[model samples]
Target: AQASFSQVFMGVAFTCGAEEEVIPFFDRGLPVEYELTRSIRVVAKTNRKKIGVLNTEAKLFGGFDFQSMRSTPPWPVVDELKKQYDVEQVSASEPIEEEYDALLIALPSSLPQKEMDHLQDYMEAGNPTLLLVDPLTIINVGLSPSEKAGANMNPFMRNQGPPPKEKGDIHALMTALGVSWNKAQIIWDQYNPHPDFAHLQPEIVFVGANNPEAFNQEHTASAGLQELVLLFPGSLRKAADSDYDFQPLVKTTPASGSLNYSQLVQRSFFGVQLVQPRFGHRPNPAAYTMAAHIKGESFPDTTNGADSDTTQTPTRVNAMVIADLDFISQQFFQIRQQAVGNLNFDNVTFFLNCMDVLVGDESFITLRKKRVRHRTLETIEEKKREFREEQLKEEQEAEAEASQALAEAQKRLSEKVAEVRQRTDLDDRTKEIMARNLQEAEQRKLDALKNKIEAKKEARIQRSKEEMEAKIRSIQSNIKVYSVFLPPLPVLGFGIFIFVRRYKREKEGAAAARRLRA
Candidate 1:
């Protein structure tokens, strides 16, 4: 699932094949190992799972916009989930009409207390929930900078104040479940870079992670996932009084910090810094939990005064809590002006895997979590970098040495010309002619020296390139030998040893039988 923007997955089943980069030199698909190229067939099942959505604000399930007086189209996430699950929008104000396999609550803190009670009733009844919480969701998406900030970059004559920032803070619900989200702050992860807005030098409210270290391999939902895009994400932490297991599935890098609104607005906190201190900074860098899975029995406190039959049994829930909701938004993942299905990150796959695992799709989970290890040829790459630095230094040294030699030669020629001018036996014309000859000879020598220096520089660069190439080839050959041939050697040796042991046993048995007959 570790994919750049230019790569895509190719497999028989959707989850079987790994991400493949289309190498330009090959003009075809990337050449991978047989296991990576391998795929398994998928058979569709009739009994699809059902997932309930609680937020109509996210427009996940398209609904009529009263302001626009038109029906807004549904998002791609709804369409994707509809393929495997029956998705329905549930009202927050009313009680959940029916029990579903799983429920999606986007921005859990935005709902009212009445709605939260309803959700508690549903969860207390043993329904699972995939809770997505974001610290700063875009209030007015797709608006120009003037419309967003209410002014251009001129920083003058701003009449209206900035729009109110929406945060997700569900202390009661999180306490009942397992974790607490610090919604007042956004997570700033320098582990991955968001490529856009680098030119504008705008505030880095956007954070992304495309490294394998960001995802926990021990967890099934987050395993094999490599990329996630987040906008103003929050941090998830275990509640002090909660007994549930709050295991982190995704984490911010140790280079990250829980950035407050003040830190976000400060220009000093942005861009690459030569010296970064985690010790006494306003917010120290730490590995905060961006996404997690909490497992335990639902606390009976929120279920009180509800219609749910709490007396039956304690509702055991396995819930996934994410610190960001923008990843699921189309504007965050979908590439504009391209195909609607194309994505810039693997957030959708990660969400789908979470849903699948929550719905208890064991077979699908198995395929999605199947990870194949591969090499990056770091040795050859390291050698290339080393040789480039070495070659550059050698060229500089050669140029300096040639320049010194030319200066000395010119000084010697000047001395000889002065000596000729001082000679009494030669005429002035002869001296002039002799000096001219000396000057021409010195010029030729200088040109020769320059030519030699240039030729040596080129040769040295070429030699270094060839040497690196040869070392890379040798490493590649050794890898092939180990992968293709070395594995069989141990098997062949074991076979020969077994054959000799069997031969000895048979001979001894035959000799014993003969002696008994005699």
Candidate 2:
């Protein structure tokens, strides 16, 4: 009966021109019901997932500006996120209306108890989330109420606010996730300095790839990042009781130290001295985790009786915690005239990569990764750079010397012509003839001098090129020689070893036979 059933299906598949599709069902002997279920699951997996941006307390998009829904300059990170995902602004006061796959919480100064409950509920339901927290919040103190409400807002307003205070609910959430957030301290690295923006405070921390302790190359989010500039970034550490797998994505250099914001503020203002020194006082300079990834078992669904089964397998939960929220803000991306939307930086790419990894959607990671194109020349060895500089200097000196010699030759020829023209002994006709001859002689000398200088310049350039090529060729030749001979050396040694062992064994066997015969 089974054979007959298979034959009937095969005939039907051939008639329907879907033999390949039917063959899979026949091979697995899957019922029609199972095939339909699998098809639905495949389609669901391919669909675009929604992302929720918590704007109620976080104000991630921007503060409560009724005129413009988005922040004045608008957050560039949101613009990038919209290109690939359906991003919806979610309020913590209301129940989440959209079926979002992930949530993004931009630096929130404060969250009410109700809002914190909503976030906790969302996270406990197994939804992935990314939290960008700031250790300090700077408010614009210079803007008046009228100027703030004006249509054209100045982007250069100076922001002066107190140090970042820890939000009780946010701290509780971090503890639950097994991540620790240092509320009182901010990171500063002496080894990695940033281009001074006069408007920004001295506490702003800048970290680059050159500072090995600051950049983690092992994580996917920060793998190819070259530099990250954080404005008053906080420090993060994993907690002992956390159940998730924790990995540091970004860090501060070994020269970095955590400064107490309260102490620094007292010293900056009020003319008070610190009781204890702040620099180089720690026993060991350690790299503090600036960003981290935590993954673990998801919360079980309790919406339905069947879903509430304790024996059911739990889903995987992924969350990314970044200490610096201002790093990805519009203020950081905008420099001078360039707007936040146009400027490309590693921080933006890193944020997008983190989002993609959290949601298990890597489709946009490659596209976003292409945004960072800055190639720093600092990677070149100092010796090689110095040699190149010396070559350039030699060329400049040679050109200067040739110019001086040409000037001297012209001056001498001009003086000789003047001497001949001024001679009183010569008659008018003779003087004119001698003057013409002298002018012609001067022209020939000038041309010869120009040619000589040109030849010298060309020779110098050619010599430099030849020397560079020679060095490159010498390196290549050494590599080639090793490539050709290195592999064969081991093989040759192994062959000789095997031959000697076999020869010795054969002789021993013959001697044993001879001894037995004797």
Identify the candidate with maximal lDDT.
Answer: 2
Q: For residue 399, what is the lDDT in candidate 2?
A: 73
Clashing pairs in 2: none
Give the alpha carbon lDDT tens digit for every residue of 341-440 in model 1. 4333556667888887777874555554343343445665455445534544554465566667778877887898899888899999999999889888
CA lDDT scores, all candidates in order: 0.61, 0.61
Best-fitting candidate, measured by TM-score? 1
Q: What is the C-alpha RMSD of each candidate to the true structure, in Å?
A: 18.9, 21.7
The parts of candidate 1 lying over 4 Å away from their true place are 1-44, 64-71, 139-169, 193-213, 262-283, 298-315, 331-344, 366-518
How many times do residue backbones clash in model 2?
0
**lDDT digits (tens) for residues 1-518 of candidate 2:** 45543434431121122212222233222223433433343334435568889874335565654323354544767865764566888887765556677899765335555676677667656678998776654432111111111212222322323322223366677776768886667676543222234234335666666656556677777876766777667888887656667889888755456766564432322222223322222312577788988888644446766645467665455788888766776655453124333333467668878888878877555544543355544523233334444455555566777778889988988888889889999988898899889989898989998899878876985687467546645655776788899999999999999999999999999999999999
